[model samples]
Target: MEFIALDILPFSVVDDVCFRRLVEHRYTLPSRSYFSDVSLPELHSIVETYIHELLAMGVTAISFTTDIWTSDVSPISMRSLTAQWVNEDFVLRKAVLHAQECAGSHTAAAISMAFEKMFETRKNPKNKVHAVLRDNAHNTTKALEECGVASLPCMAHTSGNR
Candidate 1:
């Protein structure tokens, strides 16, 4: 499961004969259905728990970065939110809080609502979010503003380096 998820390999890779032969000596690979159905959900739950625990500990302030983009080949639009903070040990930690498909238009309201949902679901307090760094798109800026979140423009976007 870790091999598939970490390497971003297709589920079908588990069924490849050569791949199976390579690892069968020490491990048994489950079916693709098992990965899609069982392993993935379990992995998600474990990671979610870890993130919640980390945030509930000594973390006081979190900086966020969010963006939305549409695929050119497909009509799918995705919005992602990432959180970064220094841990109690003074080590920097970063995690992607959300990366989900957007259903409709990328309006300010939609973006803000999505962010709120992610924070709420993760059990992270809004007050803990120090600031958001994002592209200077009107909708994105307005979205964070609507959520009462402080935002800074991404220098890459501002300088046209993105």
Candidate 2:
């Protein structure tokens, strides 16, 4: 529980410390020490393992949302694509998704190649492709088309004709 609290709970380092202390006192058990032993990189890998499992279970689809933005006040844009999917259990309806670093300057061929490479790296190739989802940009649409995959524009994104 402490491990989960530290990693996933909505709290800061201070909150974590307070929560851990409170729990320790209430339950008379040692607070979680695992955080001290695990590195951030290791935690990322562990989380990625869970992500892969979710992907393979049809919990996420190939259709992605993308945007460009800058971290600083001055605009230096970056583009990325994310895969999304849903997991429907008895009481919970959760969505799983992830984004990958990508270049805005890349051509259709390049984007397609990059995505293809990404798919190859995934443990389940079949789950990585959602035949119906489409790319918003014309270049990405063409790239998706080259794969012999049907691509449709996101209807929600279409300009409203007033």
Candidate 3:
């Protein structure tokens, strides 16, 4: 039940007979409120621990990708940050660093601050962030410059308003 909701699935999934049969009566799903109060926070903690473990794996260089967007149904804009790295085994690894509300005005400074906050906990000495890949918007490019890191334009940023 908790993992369903965390994965952005419907909470009522556990109510399905097929799902219950799949679990085979070995576990009872917790209520929505119980999941909210206990399971969600615990799961977040677990993920945080996992992220730390991943970052500590001596990756040499990391990159970031980010975007901000708003919905027609809501008056708020949100930003998502993703981290990319090549591991010791030479496999590319990616992780979602954050999905957070873009507070204050949508200025270059504000977005720069958002980048700073996103990287607050990812200061592994073994890894160096090479660049941030983002859209080629005026504000976004300016924000990247303000963050003082090398910035690369995303190849798919063809939409003018993005």
Residue 33 in candidate 2 has what lDDT? 50
Query: Which prediction has the highest lDDT against the true structure?
Result: 1
Clashes of each: 0, 1, 0
Of 1 and 2, the candidate ahead on lDDT is 1
Model 2, span 22-66: residue lDDT tens: 565556532335343454446667767877766656454445454
TM-score of 2: 0.55
Give the lowest summed-lDDT range of ten residues in model 2.
Answer: 89-98
What is the Å distance of residue 132 in model 2 from its true position? 6.0
Among all windows of 10 consecutive residues in model 3, the one with the lowest summed lDDT is: 118-127
lDDT of 2 at 70: 46
TM-score of each: 0.93, 0.55, 0.82
- Displacement of the residue 49 alpha carbon in candidate 2, Å: 0.9
**The CA-based lDDT of model 2 is what?**
0.54
Clashing pairs in model 1? Answer: none
RMSD of each candidate relative to the true structure: 1.9, 5.8, 3.1
Clashing pairs in 3: none
Query: Which scores higher on TM-score, 1 or 2?
Result: 1
User: Distance (Å) between predicted and true CA of 68, model 1?
Assistant: 0.3
Name the top TM-score candidate: 1
